[model samples]
Target: MTNHIIVTIGRQFGSGGHEIGNKLAERLDIPLYDRNLVNMAAEQMKISPDAAEEVDETGLSRFLAYYASAPVDYSSYYMTNIEMGQPLSEQLYQVQSEIIKRLAGRSSCVIVGRCADSLLADEPNLINVFITASKEDRVKRIVEKYGLTERKAAERIKKIDRERRYYYELHTGKDWGSIESHDMLLNVSAMGIDGAVDALEALYKAKK
Candidate 1:
């Protein structure tokens, strides 16, 4: 059966979530939106991609009050913010959310991070996924990937995971990796990338 499904992946830093997403998208012949999302948002907002990257998935506590008070016209919110001189972080979020919605409406795709799960929560065709891995496995992957010592890899994992958790909670008011937050959670360490991809593809087929 042909499936039109939007897979939103929330993953820990060292988890093979990105690899899985790429493989799944390839298998399904669908577009994969990851860091390219930042570029897309930046282009729409008429800002440098580097500017968007600065606040990508990082909490904005100091600017939340201002953002909360802004008038929200979902139709043109991002453009409105550009005209209103909103902070870059707020602008990026608004633009990216709009872009994600537009992309979902246009086609089924796999979106990695940037709170795509929560942003598209109301969509009927959405599949929310969270990817995690054992700490030891994550550390090992990080050490190998970055040529870092085990201790440094462990530290990096903790810091990135903490930032992800904080950003997710701040934006969605939901626990980052809590089982209840997602339609499915996969442990990359247990299943490995290819196995995880197969499982997700199977799940999508079943759901469709």
Candidate 2:
């Protein structure tokens, strides 16, 4: 059967979620949307890629994104306090939501983060997965990947996870990383990244 299943993954900071998503996409021969969603949203917003990155996913309140997309010159170039009702982070989220919907409409693919699970919640072919790991394991992964001390890795994980949680909650009105919000929650600390991928592959096929 030709399956068109959309898999959306939410991961902890150092849980190897992106790696799992990338591997899953490769295994299934489907496109993976992770960091590339920022670029795609930038293009959609008619702004430079870096502009989108400025307000990409941190949920920061800034006007750089507004200035980048708005047709305003120096007259209001420094109007960083302009009230556009929605923050730059929210605007980026809206744009990426459109992209996610369009991508899901086109074919089966794997989307990492950006609250894609909630955005595509109505689709029958949608499978939402949240991957997590123990703090110890995650800290080790972060330290190894970034050459950071264990203390630094733990700190970084806390910061990014908090931002992601707030971002997800702000947009979706759902508790981030909760099992009830997703279709499947994978604890890959012991199973490993590839093992998690194997389980997800089976899930996609079984869901079909």
Query: Candidate 1 regions off by >4 Å?
Result: 1-3, 58-85
Q: Each model's C-alpha lDDT?
A: 0.80, 0.81
Candidate 1: tens digits of C-alpha lDDT, residues 1-208:
1235899999998898888999999998889999899889878767665456667774322133233464322323223354677766677878898898889888789999988999888887788999999999999897877677899778778877888898788888998999988888899888899989999898778767
Clashes of each: 0, 0
Give the per-residue lDDT digits (tens) of candidate 2, residues 32-132: 99889988987877766655665666522133234236542323212232467665566777889898888888889999998999988878788899999
> Top lDDT: which candidate number?
2
Report the error of model 1 at residue 31, Å: 0.3
Q: Which ten residues in a row have the lowest lDDT in candidate 1?
A: 59-68
TM-score of each: 0.84, 0.85
The clash tally of candidate 1 reads 0
